[model samples]
Target: MQLMHKGSALVTDQDIGENPSVIEHAKRMGLRLITFGPHCNAQVREMGFHNGNLQIGMGSLRLGISLQSDGHHMALNAQAALAALHALGYAPAQVQASLAHWQPMIGAGQPQLLPSGICLLDHSLSNHLLSMTAAFSQLQSVAPHVSRRLIVLAGIQPGQASIDAAQLALEPLVRDAQARRVLLYGEPLRPLAAALGDLLHVNWYDDLNQLICSLLRTTHKGDTVLLAGRATTNLALAADAIRDSFSGHGGHLIASIQAPCFDPHQKQMNMHS
Candidate 1:
């Protein structure tokens, strides 16, 4: 909060505006403030989710902006982004057009479509328990028509506090997502096997290769896999492995994992299969 000097503005959500600390800080810093949400009085407001997208509008006007993303939380993020652009003096039409093709960056809800017809939602970049739960909710909301739902979690924290939270939250989230299987890597998350043992089929892996091998063998057409955790390198390799596995038979599976290279000329990240 201290970093925000006078004349600098904070664009946030209505829910966050109610924080006493934030209110006090803004008052102290003489910070310009913009808040967005579904609240009737918010500067930017949202309508209900429809057809896998979010609709938002400025104040009480009809929702004129459509965001190509799922989840109510994501709608708030879109509103905040729009509010920031508004603060920067971008015209509403310009901002709307720019956001039309917006997609989440790699490891942040980016959906990778594989040749084998699997849609992998990568959320490994920010894989705290809260984010993991939100990922499941988003998947449930957006891709309910998918044939199979698989969840891969890597590098769960082994601390008792984390495990306890997982114990309370993991099973319900997985059930709500209607996931067919839960594949867990890293020894830290092995304890989750017991918690989810009866309601769902859980697999634990100590080796990344083994997990990749199993994933390749088991997942079929029209499946959606949600990948989330701390081992980002391992997660990227796994996603690439899945993509390359369907490219050819034997030799291609051994191909080196390709990093998501940014191609400035194309103005998008290029994924090599």
Candidate 2:
């Protein structure tokens, strides 16, 4: 998930749990990295990074850049995409969106691909907070059976101490618990889960390895997991490690929503390797 900025050499570090040394290399290239979780440094929040977007903090005169962020209307696009896909075939029973490192995920492979052109492209500030709000009503439409499907979210936020942005997404995600079954799990989940509820929350880290292992064992092809937050690198690497741990017995264990979107043609992220 490490992408060098297009014009100049500015690579923003998106994950906080990654090796600091590699991030230093990115810095040497004139790229700035941003962290979006509690484990991040104070300086990261000072720069305007939290959820999934990383604003290059390096002194600029730069041109066309390679920036990676999935905040704001990005959720809108997922919502629209889900709706369209539902009408098509994928018929995702439920849709949940959040900024707790887990964002909404769109699966490929045998996913019952929906129509295209329904992605969110706006990365504006004004558009970020309201992204979740706009989709809230849409989230309310699921039937009881459809709500049984759990939609998880994970990603960095756009601002610091992310209460506003988090709530923006949370308000809608938890609106339906009986039918939709929204689960909120994260490192700092006690307060959030209490404020939100078990049906809508859980302290994520409490059973991280176990939970991931369980998911790896039971998750099907059409199901998706959106991993965001912390440093993009750390989360990505963690996912990599988790996948590797399950390598060999079954088919590919990790199916990410990362881009270049993950060319299934290659069947792996490190295509260069």
Q: Which residue segments of model 1 deviate by more than 4 Å?
A: 1-3, 18-28, 59-63, 142-147, 155-168, 175-178, 247-251, 254-273
Candidate 1, 1-273: lDDT as tens digits: 688668887888888876788888899999877888887656777766665466676744554555665555666777788888877877666777666677666677766677667787877775466777778776775568634788877744434575546544566666666577777776555556556656536676666666676677677778888887775437766766666676455345553322212222322111111
Q: After the best TM-score superposition of candidate 1, give how far the Cα of residue 84 lies from its true spot, in angstroms.
A: 1.4
Error of 2 at 58 (Å): 38
* lDDT of candidate 2 over 1-273, digit per residue (tens): 355652232222234325677566656666544332223341222233334443222223111211222443343333333333433344233322222234333221011111221121111112233443333322233213442233333332546656535544554344443323332334433344455543432323333433344334433333332233334213343344333433333234343323222234422111112
**TM-score, one value per model:** 0.77, 0.32
Model 2, position 174: C-alpha lDDT score: 46
* Regions more than 4 Å wrong, model 2: 1-148, 155-171, 177-185, 198-203, 217-273
Residue 36 of model 2, lDDT score: 27
Candidate 2 local lDDT, residue 123: 13
- Measured over all alpha carbons after superposition, the RMSD of each candidate to the real structure, in angstroms, is 9.0, 19.3
